[model samples]
Target: MTRLPPVPWTARADLAELVAALGPGNLRWVGGAVRDTLLGQPVKDVDAATPLLPEEVQHRLAATGLRSVPTGIAHGTITAVLAEGPVEVTTLRRDVATDGRHATVAFATEWRDDAARRDFTINALYADPVTLEISDYFGGLADLADRRVRFIGDPAERIREDHLRILRYYRFQARFGAELDPAAEAACAELAPTLKGLSRERVAAELLNLLGLSDPASTVARMDKAGVLPIALPERTPDGISLLSQVIAWEQAHAIAPDPLRRLAALLPADVRLADGAAARLRLSTAQRKRLSKAAGRGGDDAMDARALAYRLGMAEALDQMALTGGDPAPIVGWTVPAFPLKGGAIIARGIQAGPDVARILRMAEDRWVAEGFPDAGRATQLLEASIADAKIA
Candidate 1:
């Protein structure tokens, strides 16, 4: 018999106290904490499920002098702030009704009901923190041991509850390197069309998370094959996917961290207009749009001008463009960019007359300065004087 692992209560006093306060029957550690612990992976968030209702949860935590914030009271979730970390405790819930986007849930006393309501078996495991007993209602342990991501019960029914689960199913596989359950894939293929109805923010988050994991290229390629990728990014191209594979290879070669937008830029239709359209569809922020724009913009010989462009358009953007265009980011990052030695005043003092023309002349000179490997101050002055002489003759 595979008994549940004992939680280290002494190590995490806040968790111990929170569970103790809620009493044994009301509190059990659930979700990632239990799953990751079993997998021998680092666990960041502590999630718990409880039989206690929202109001009673508030009352009990308050009585213990612990702060309880109603982060998702309607979902029966209250976050207890403590020195250890915020432990999110949600009452066991059963879905009463669900659209493709949101679920109308009612609190439940039975743990199996809550487990059944979840999307994947691996995610539905629960553990009693006190008793050190693991609960695997939907054969989550068997699935986890086999490294297969199976939907709980019927695939179509589960996906019908929420369309985002189609993306999530792949994302989960990407993280765990698990093979997709065939039925789930077919079901996802059928329900893939409903992805458009979900909020862009939700879709964006799932895509990014999927992209953040290891070897996302294969998973994303599989999604594209399944007709899921086209729904999420209509501008996606086969040629772009080919480029994405190379981009990911370069990222690995250079030890670059996973960048979803840069990778997305690679998978876009090689046009800024299409990039903007895709970015808009994802509801990317202004900064994100600008970054994506710079990356997806028409190719430039950025190898020579990377340093100069770094100052003009942040190092990150320049480096992103450089990498997106298959240039090495190593040298670009270390390249010491020099500031333009000539200011507007210097151009004005040249008797070139002060106006937009002066600004334009100064800009032209600056371009020359950048082109000429950022000349010395004496050389720059000579260039400025010569330009002024030319201006007088005109």
Candidate 2:
């Protein structure tokens, strides 16, 4: 008899219209939308389930002038694009076959059967869109109330159904777990090796998502102890966990936002080669790979001021290195690295022949400018004259 309290998403007219188009009794709010709503947390994505087939759901949506996309039609999912945001409406389905990486599913009409095929109990709760009544086929209500993430039927069976659940178990545990469900933990540990079969993109996405959470250090340490971390990221050292904890502490103290890539950098050894290798294995974007590589080296003792470091390395990477090395970011907080004033053209205009000499003189002037702490354009001109004098004497 649990009821969902009034939430912001449920009041949207477009959602109501989609539900009405799908039919009154056939659809209900399900999955994370329901789970987060009941927990009083802000829900980002809204999802629903219906006994109606995907084609029927699409037709009904079109009839109501709502746009529907076959986002995952093979899995009985169709996305209803509303003005507020996209709500994924899926037909109820039961797994016909699972190979730990993917599943072959058959559409089902019974809600309980569909819910039974889900990975976690708390994620299987459904709420009637109109009456707000919750339908809990498993012990989802109690488990959710206890903030425990328990697999729906059997932990090993669920992990066998989808190997990615091994990582997902820890991620959900970090988000909502009060105590480790011993069974799920054991199953995840035993089946951790199966994660290698998943796509590198999927693995990277989940790992980054876990690190993106608020204070995932303790959960990551637990994952390390459970033998899951080595399989997911073999490059991690024992000290990296403690380092990650320190990084999180520094971020919190400085009121800096949590960054997954920066945290990942902290979890790695201070070696540029290893950072590049990890970035390659994770299939990270070019910019992300460069940032990770830049953050791999140790910081705070280079003797260059924060602005100098910021100028050499981009500002974001500088801040990340500073935080990872326990250096104060106060100096770089609002400071912008000023650009060098003198250019090669100005050196050529100074009666220096436009050849290697101009390039050489420009280099010397720029170096002096940087060394002198990036003085004003006027001082830069004086430095240029000094460089010209030095070059003539040489």
Candidate 3:
């Protein structure tokens, strides 16, 4: 039997205090925190499973002078903000009905009853905040030690409960599981069609999370081979898949910048039709949408010329684009584009009338400025005058 690592005593004490304040037998540290603690991963969020309903949890949290948010009251979840951080407390629930995409659940009091309803074994592990003792209604501890991500019951049943799990299965495998259970793989294959019923935003969010995990190229390739990608992004090109492995490697080497737009831009295809509709459907931020547009429009020529490079993308974005494509972006120098030395006002001041000619002469001057290695305003003006004179003779 593999021995689990000891829980962080400091975190346990903190949670114990919160549980004491809420009263014993009312809450238990649950979900990812428990599972991650056993696996030795740094816990990011602390979650609690409570017998009390959402309203009760809210009232109790209020007494502690901590803010409470009804994040998912209908689903029996209340977010309590403590001095250290926010903890999500959800009441025990059992699924009354499900339609592959959403679940209608009824509140319950039994921990095992709640455990039975969850998606995976590893996710069902719970710990008593006061005693620090773990309660594994399912074989979550074993699965974690084994490095497997098995469904709680029948894999098909779990997938039917939430089709998003099809993508999540692969994501978990990429992150924690070293091998895929044959039955789980088969179930995902059978239910791959149900993924189409899910919202684009849901699918995009899951896909992005999966991408954020380890070796996204391999994970994406596995998803593609399993036929999950088609339901999520049907228009993705063959080249997209071919490029993904290289992109993943590049991203890994670069230590992953915090900008989601830059990361999303690297994954986007050169074809607008492939990226535009998906970006809109996912409701990506305006910056992300613009980055995708620029990435698609520029294609592999993103690093070709200084003007194209500086005008189309920032230095960091240029480096990301180069890294994504597995090229050296060092050629794209950091030279600032000398501000277009001749604005419309400047052109008008030079006796260029305020008509279409004003716009035209400015364009001509800008071209001369760029051609003259982007010199200062005075040199640019001299070059513009010489070009205008030569054009008149022609």
TM-score of each: 0.89, 0.93, 0.82
Candidate 2 residues 319-354, lDDT tens each?
A: 888888888888788888888877888977766667
Across 181-264, the per-residue lDDT of candidate 3 in tens digits comes to 888988998889999888887887887787666566676777778887767777566667666666666656655444434445
Which candidate model has the greater TM-score, 2 or 3?
Answer: 2
- Model 2: CA > 4 A from native: 336-343, 351-394
Candidate 3 Cα lDDT to native = 0.74
lDDT per model vs. reference: 0.82, 0.89, 0.74
Task: Give lDDT: candidate 3, residue 255.
Answer: 55
Instruction: Tell how far residue 120 is off in model 1, in angstroms.
Output: 0.5
Model 3, runs deviating above 4 Å: 1-17, 253-269, 281-286, 300-303, 306-308, 315-320, 330-394
Question: Count of backbone clashes for each model?
Answer: 0, 0, 0
lDDT of 1 by residue, 23-115 (tens): 767887788887878887878898989988989999999998999899999789899998878988899999999998999999999999999
The runs of at least 3 residues in candidate 1 whose Cα sits more than 4 Å from the true structure, single-residue gaps closed, are 1-10, 334-354, 372-394
Indicate the worst ten consecutive residues by lDDT in candidate 1. Answer: 1-10
Q: Could you tell me the lDDT of residue 253 within candidate 2?
A: 95
